[model samples]
Target chain A: MYNPQAENIIIVKDLVKKFGSFYANDHLSFEVKKGEIFGFLGANGAGKTTAIKILCGLSYPTSGKLNVGGFDIYKEREKIKRNIGYMSQKFSLYDDLTVFENIRFYAGIYGLRRKEIEERAASLMQKLDMKEARDKLIRSIPLGWKQKLAFSVAIIHNPKIVFLDEPTGGVDPVTRRQFWDMIFEASSEGITVFVTTHYMDEAEYCDRVSIMVDGRIAALDTPDNLKKHYGAGSMNEVFLKLARVKVE
Target chain B: MKRFLGFVVKEFYHIFRDYRTLLILFGLPAIQLLLFGFVITNEIKDARIAILDQSKDEVTRRISEKVLSSGYFILDKNLTSYKEIEQVFRQGNIRLVLVFGPDFSKNLDKTGNARVQIIGDASDPNTANILVNYLQGILSNYLISLNAEKIPMQIVPEVRMMYNGQMKGVYMFVPGLMAMLLMLISALMTSLSITKEKELGTMELLLVSPLKPIQIIIGKVFPYVFLAFIDACIIIILGNTVFGVPVVGSVGLLLLESFLYICMALSLGILISTITSSQQIAMMLSLVALMLPTILLSGFIFPVENMPWILQVFCHIMPPKYFITIIKSIMLQGNGFRYIALETGIMAGFTLFFIFLSVKKFKIRLA
Candidate 1:
């Protein structure tokens, strides 16, 4: 029943996850604040997915103290689940389902009242400028629109936080920018965004970024601050500098 | 409750919208029932044969009359020479040719012996064998009648076939078809659909939602259970109407037992989903582990009693084997729960065991 403190919505302390003596996540710790976009960055096989899974309640931590939305990870996993929304790297909407059907499905599982689901779904379509395409199956829509639709459905329940696992992978830059616009709009409505990405440019758009190397948090700061601290001119160079160091 | 209802509705959407699943769920049972009931049956009707009576005597003519009246064969031709036997068979219509030796009932009167030659087309071995057997039965009965007055003390054997009196092939294959179709819809299709969600990454999204793991699994199973039940009804109706196989037991009890078996199959599907993470792997495992084993070892095409010891042991472990047994007993023998309670109990036990095993495995894999 310990408090998560005033500013932080997520708190992790010495989170250790091991798979048969191999530490997929080794002694990790970080915090995400309310209404802030926190970017989680890592190279492939650097354990970012494992950490996100732990936070999302999809996996168990070997040993650690973790809390999200003021609920213990060990005791109140269900409460944590209720408070968060997630979209995976793959566009997770049903390809056979229409856009409105997809939205209603997520809204329904979140236990939204019928009238509320209807109102939100109509407005969600308006926001995406997809009212004309609302009845189209997800497979028939363009990739960019599908990605945006996926993000919109992920937050249909008005969760306190939305987790996007490399949400912009393989998307065009213009669409990625539009997607970030939606993210900014949600943050303005006080929905904290916790996202992971391989794109350094997307990392720069986040309020703060954490880089994990070899299952440990090697760097955590504002993108501009990290750039200045490393004496590099861009976040890309800053990433290259940290990732090239070999771990003993 | 509303939330769970919505989840089930979505599942139904997936099922109905997919044409492939629809075909397998509804179309397959009917196709299989017809194929096994009528087209591939073992019973013979109106087989054609030719007659060659060289003696042209009363005995040969009487034998020919009896053969035609048996209702199993048609007289394709009356041949006067032996060369016509080979020619009739080459036409592929005649299954057998009966030839009588030269005699006017003289040999039977003088030496108390008569000879007849039966030539059969063996291109299709099974039909040839059965045709020969039927001819033998007809000739032997005729000979018995002829010797009725001359025999001294004789012992006659009374032969009566119980359960299925005529050994109709539909009686045997209908129960087996029911087992295969139910398992296909319940276990194989359910496992495929569940793993499809995992492969598409929606399972991760669902897990991150408010729905509990058990609720998710149940929601996935409900639609398939309903579909499989409908399929079972279709098979039973077809078996009764088209094939004339009766449900001699209580109709309600038959449905209830089928429901129990469907639950067992659905739970096994969930267990398979827990172990596999991709649709292709789930599909391969379901076909290899469940479908093939059920069809081959469940006494469907082959009798479990006639199988080798190792295969018999395998059949005993097969869930569909017990289902086919229960179906045959209840439908053919007019048996009630008193007779098939053991199989029903075994299926219920499997349902519980699969549910428990999947719960434990799911927890250990994640939290």
Candidate 2:
């Protein structure tokens, strides 16, 4: 069960998204607590992205009761968009632009003032230990550094929630751990983290994990509780146990 | 508004860094103008022809001399009999064959009538037609001189070639090149830049931001408009200084009309962007649907009046047709906004239609 004391920042009930005759996301219900890392796990074509898109206001639902950042999904999409940060599998930094330029570009889009952008960009570079790479073009940096920069840029606006879609894909093991540490640091600052991944080991790092099979969320619980209830050795075994029941 | 300015600055950064795009934006137009203005021309320098004169009389000889000295034809071969005409035509080197039927001077004295046959290879119809027409003109001059005292009732027709008295080739090509260049820069560049962001996923980030979809599209198109305006200025200056193409009308009105045409092209580009999700598709569509049609059907190189009925209908719908007509009216015809009101009005209507259609087609969701 989810923490009873933790406040629900994102609430969804009977959320359904369809593409013509096909159901991309079926009736789904879940709650994400404030300031906790929530893992959205799924196989290919399991509709994890559909759910995330609805929450982020990038897509419309066929029928649903969904709320994000205290705004109704149908009525206040503009409000929800202002309150959340997003990073997709493909990094959205301009390759031809320098690190400082990329940071300024995103911060500028968020309507940050000139003096605030200068001050915040300096501190952000110091925190990421990327002060040296600040003037270097994004294309000249390593992939891991670029991924970390993308995440830092995404949260530069200090949104209440950050939705990361496979942020550690193709990253090495050590870098993935470092990325999770960053996520934890972000969560400690009272920012909610909703991330999707296919890596089972990463599921244990989340405060709560949801396993989506087909279009429905098959399991939603803490990693240890999910393992204990399924009588499995790890979160991986629990995921497989739930995913094996194929939907018609 | 500040956020929109930031977006435009980023677009400029992308454009400045991509040297290939920069070249296409600025260099291609100048090079195309020079190539079209100087290299590709409508005038014939020297055309080759063969003569098969059966009656080698004084009159026929004098006519052949006059035709050769007209500077349009070079006598490639002289044949003795009728069989040589077909052989020389099949040689593929000669463009025209002139044959004179029996005694030309003797027949003129007896019956005041003569027959001269000018045969042209019609494989390349334009050049063949020009050659035949030139031969007929020279023949007429000779006939008028010969019958100067004989026919007092000859009605003299006075002709004058207006607008381009010198018959310079650049006058026809400059307006056309302007239309093609502006379309490529304003329409093609905007669509490509937009679809590039979609492919790179940056567009999604913009969508999720506080920036509205309209703001995003406007920002993406703003830099191209600035660059294309600079391009239009360069085309006008070069056309004036290099080719002596005068902007005889109000220069301000000419530039104003150019900007309006640019707006129409940009709206078309946005429409193209809305319907496509990939840069390659956007580029191919811009080229096939915009560039090729504008160049061929807009009466740029070929006259719309000369095209087939079906194609003339297609040309009427083409936006470039109106744009080219307006430019020529302003530059060559020295007409003001009053004279070009119909053309400018049609272009404005096209811009509104495209903007309305694209805004309708644009959807915020993949669903």
Candidate 3:
């Protein structure tokens, strides 16, 4: 049972998003609790990214009662942005900058002092055991390391929630496993994670998952419960069965 | 504020690390100043002309000597017959042919008048007219000394050129150089910085950051202001030291105006970056849009006043035209801000307008 008194990290009610009269997110509603690892699963163009953009304060929902970290996205966008971290699928780290410099730059942009940036960078790099490659440029590092570093820098300010948009995309299984471990660590520290991914195995890693299809949440429950209800062997089978049944 | 400082420092790192940017920021202004200062000039030096001295008298020889010694014209060949004058003119090397009639001195004494024809190749009419006038002035000066005994019939007007008094090309070009150099650096920086973010995928990251749209723009523009200021200083120093062009107005005022113009140019760069998605397009757009107009329409090389009505109207719209006007007025004419208030105001308006448009475009993109 969801706690009645405990704070909801994200609250969305009747969200509607339109791009030139083409509805991307229509009448969508969801709630994510504090410190919860909420999985948002959808195929490409299911309005998942649009919904995330509105939540992250990058865009305005057409009509909605959207809240992130107890702040209204429309009224307190700047405050919301300050208290949330975002890592995009493209892995937005400066390729020309060294590992330490990238960390310092992001920390600075989040309004950390020079000394504070240095201190936090040292701790973050230490946590990742990246001391040997701190001076190396991001372009010189492997893709997996870059993704991990991007995620770490996103949360360097220690925000209440971190939004990961396909954070494990394109990485191998081992790297994806390591990326999820970091996500778990963040959630353990009372940081809510709102993630969207196509990887079904990664979906099982979340506490609760929502499968969106055609701008609507087709199914929402624990991965195990959904698998049991659908009588499927894995999350992938459940998702495939749901997708096919909707088409029929 | 701390985040803004960090962003600015990172911007400095971007500028300082790139060798191509370093060259454009520093190397270009210096090279352009040197070229404008020395190699390119409007002042004619040792212009070659042939003399057809039919009189061969002492007065004619003395007059011809005076013409050759003025440092304007060098005697290239002495023509024998009148037919040779046409051949020399056809060669295109001789700009002027000084023809003295057989009765040049006698006609001067008896009739109180004399004929000395200066036939110049009129294909390039402006240069030809200038050459003819110069030869006439030299010969008249010689005749004036001999005509004290007789009443002087023709009153030759004394002309004194001002500002670039000698009409040195560098003096004319220095202001142009300042506008051009600032435009090049500003446009290149804005375009490259934006495209670089797109290339590294960090633009999206910044979009997701807590920094406001205005903060990102201000942060990107800050380092470029410093680079443009340094370039302006180099151009001014080279203009004065190498080209002998004086800072006739308040040097402080000139610097202030230069800073304002740099902002205008940088704003244009920012505007260009807002529309362009790649570095190659930005560079090409800046070169074609900013560079060509700054050179041709700003009246740097071609006289905008003499251009067609439409082109002159077009030149009026260019930011460099205002900048060049202010620079020349302040640096060469020693005119104060009061004299160039309108031009300075126009440049300031342009800066504000560009900044506004860029911010609007940036915000729209974010939305």
TM-score each candidate.
0.94, 0.96, 0.88
Per-residue accuracy of model 2 over A173-210 as CA lDDT, tens digit each: 99999999999999999899999998999999999999
lDDT of 3 by residue, B50-168 (tens): 99988888878889889999999999999988999989989889998989888878887788677778888998887888888888778767767766567647676778998867777
Steric collisions counted per model:
0, 0, 1
Error of 1 at A206 (Å): 1.2
lDDT of 1: 0.90
Worst 10 residues of 3 chain B by lDDT: B147-156
Docking class of 1: high
So what's the TM-score on candidate 3?
0.88
| lDDT string, candidate 1, B252-312, tens digits | 9899999999999999999999999988888888888998988899988877888899999
Candidate 3's DockQ is: 0.61
Candidate 2 chain B: 10-residue stretch with minimal lDDT: B358-367
Off by over 4 Å in 1: A1-6, B50-56, B75-94, B97-104, B119-123
What is the per-residue lDDT of model 1 for residues A1-248, given as tens digits with 9 covering 90 to 100? 11235378889999999999899899998888888899999999999999999999999999999999889999998898889999999989999999989999999999998899899989988888999998999999999999999999888888888999999989999999999999998888888899999899898899889999999999999988899999998899988999987342
Please rank every candidate by TM-score, starting with the best. Answer: 2, 1, 3
Question: In model 3, where do residues sit more than 4 Å from their true spots?
Answer: A1-7, A113-115, A228-233, A237-248, B49-67, B75-151
How many collisions between residues are there in candidate 3?
1
